[model samples]
Target: MNKYVLSLLCVSSMSFAATPFIYHDFDEAMQIRNYPKAFALTNRILNYDGKQFFELGRSLYNQYNPSVLPSRSEPIIPKHIHQIWIGGPLPEVFKKYIDTWKQMHPDWGYTLWTDENVRELFPLHNQSYYDESEGMGVKSDLLKWEIIYRFGGVYVDVDYECLQPLDELHHLYDFYTAYQPLDAFFVQLGAALYAAHPEHLILKHCIETIQDDWHHKGAPKKSGPCHFSKSFMAVAGENGSRDIAFPSFYFYPLGSKERVLRRSQWVREGAYAIHHWAMSWMPINTRRQEFRTFENERSSKVWND
Candidate 1:
């Protein structure tokens, strides 16, 4: 076994042990809108005491006073589709899936950015900075914001299989993202498949917040879903009518029991794009093996039925 794989397994073990406590504390913090407490809980779960978590909480608290509604002008059709792969080309199965999307939308531009290219596009001040065991994954999360902010478009994770053209959905909102429900109380707005016009305030807020709080213990908590959810909620509030938020069935349908039980039926009914839950933060070798196994299982189930 590779040293990196061993390290990741150890981290995974630790995470499994800590998950219950993390969930309890996070639920409590989010209930009262105590972002500082939430951040502290995340740090404890991840077993690190860094300045990034506290700083992120403070920055968000100061930045979240949205007194005015964002301008709802005519929506612009985003032209670019951005995907990031830091290690190398995507696996053959994923590439084929992306190609199907390209064939469906020939006019749309696709850009696959690598690690060096991402760093060149968005330079970090501290070259030695690292976040979590999967540092590159954190960088990938940050890169998505910079790329989308610079050139307005949809940023999709490569693992997501695009089932149809997003042109119609693109015209519906100036900015949009789907929900990944954490529990009954918390609905985390996902970053996997989102579209926005250049310089959208919510996207701007996400980018700025990540930049200020770049060095946290956990990437997902600091700059991934948690950060995006908080920033979005701050600007959009709890009002469902304010922004275009898709139900989980549209973007993240794989994890649900209903979807797993009625896989084919669910796939045919909705789901413009399906997130594979690639678990990209794991070691590359581990994730690649898991991806292959998952794809095989899904394909067998979906096709055989």
Candidate 2:
């Protein structure tokens, strides 16, 4: 069943109804550095079943740090978000975005899934980071997609700023993604998207099918769909409910020929989210022509609003 289809009212009732299952993993604990909280939350979730194995793992974790418990109340939100997972390491900067989100939508609530505690409950055979770009015979990016298939809710890059209510995206489609193609032209990345939607098969397939070739070819020479996560949409096209692609201005600004081309499209289309894949805390290029799109849009009524 499409969980979100349950009308906002019904979703609210079941948002935190089911306790998440857990597994045991030592590496995850070290990486996330939050073993105590993870173990404590697990015990609370599995307290009713009295499962022997889970009990043992919970005991081990608790022995190390006795003060952990399931978040009595997940930060409240308007609807139920099945499972929200963040793939990378949790850094301090990311917390600012979370705070921004909370400030923007006080009622919105969602749980965060991290590798840190997941392995403790459900152990996986392979858990390490690898980076390979195009034709390098590397499947590193696949990590993000794997999580998307199993979870739902919004998946955003740590660098992205929460500018508006996520609820607004509910009507657009089952998925949403940034669009950045290389060409010194324009394209979006897949850092932000709605996952756990059945339609996401399109994105999953696109990544598996196109990533190697796109990376090998590099930017400027790459085709539109070949760009990877940026254009990857929910396979379920427009079915009364469909995935929509927002403009770059929402995330990335026009700062160069590449920026201009990419941001121009979104400028004309007027996007809801701006991707900062190429531009993080610093500017991409100094050419005023390039920054024009992002700069002008940054001060516009749309940006201020």
Candidate 3:
């Protein structure tokens, strides 16, 4: 047989020998270049394992299964907020938006780390991962995980606008993030906005996974959501008691197209913040014209208002 066919056979056999439910679908999806679908299936399997363990833990600890406990009933916002800018000075619009958040939560502490600061702060062993990132955007994305892991807090993309005090939602879980579904088979937990306590294993795993597995291929999403999603699933599978998933609408109320169109009306009441989809750090080209236009419009709205 041809080399390609032989490789496929070997991959299929290896997948079959591993966890049947876990790796089979993932391998199939990978073969077809349906990375998103593969990731989604992996996440689903991991979540299932998490839920199972959670149920068992509750039964053993509480002497009753609290399987139906509401995940979002309580708010548990952490005391810290982190934002990063790798290139240079924080833009005027982002500054204004952050100022608004400060006005609403005067007691909370905020830190804006620069590229140099991030490089200085991150662990030395992981420097290669940071350096190998596709661009500043992916580098920034990778840094956020380390920041949140080292110091428990809410990490928000500068492009997002805070609508209210996040403390209420923060109190809900020890580690929390929302899913950004690209399609039925591809659901990604956004790194755009997430909250985690210090030494959270998932955050550590994400950092290490990026360091070990990042191959300098694919889009920024690969290093960001795709990597984060898979790491999260692995963590959830290992420890199942925490609430790791949040509905997408909480952070990303509007879809990618609507975000660019500036459809403010589509903002759901349940949304805690709005991701303006600022692809500002993205490479400039004709296809990204919409990103540029929306960014200009958003800047105007934030600065002029």
- Please provide TM-scores, in order, for all candidate models, with all chains considered together: 0.62, 0.43, 0.65
Which of 1 and 3 is the better model by lDDT?
3
Relative to the unseen true structure, what is the C-alpha lDDT of residue 277 in candidate 3, on a scale of 0 to 100?
67
After superposition, candidate 3 runs with Cα above 4 Å error = 1-77, 181-185, 219-222, 237-240, 259-268, 286-305
The best candidate by TM-score is 3
- lDDT of candidate 3 over 1-305, digit per residue (tens): 85533543333333221121111121222122433343446346433342333233223223211132333554444578898876656666465456545655678899888856676685634677666544566667777888888878889888766654566545546676666533334455677888888878888888777754454354343467667776766665245535445545555655554424332332223345567666665533422343454232322222211
With a 3 Å backbone cut-off (N, CA, C), the pairs that clash in candidate 3 are 75-168, 75-171, 75-172, 76-170, 76-171, 76-172, 77-170, 77-171
lDDT of each: 0.54, 0.35, 0.55
Number of backbone-clashing residue pairs for each candidate, in the order shown: 0, 34, 8
- Say which prediction, candidate 1 or candidate 2, comes out ahead on TM-score: 1
Stretches of candidate 1 exceeding 4 Å from the true structure: 1-75, 124-134, 181-186, 211-215, 237-242, 256-264, 283-305
Candidate 3: how large is its RMSD? Answer: 16.0
Model 2 weakest 10-residue run by lDDT: 296-305
Q: Rank the candidates by TM-score, best first.
A: 3, 1, 2
Provide the lDDT at 284 for model 3. 34
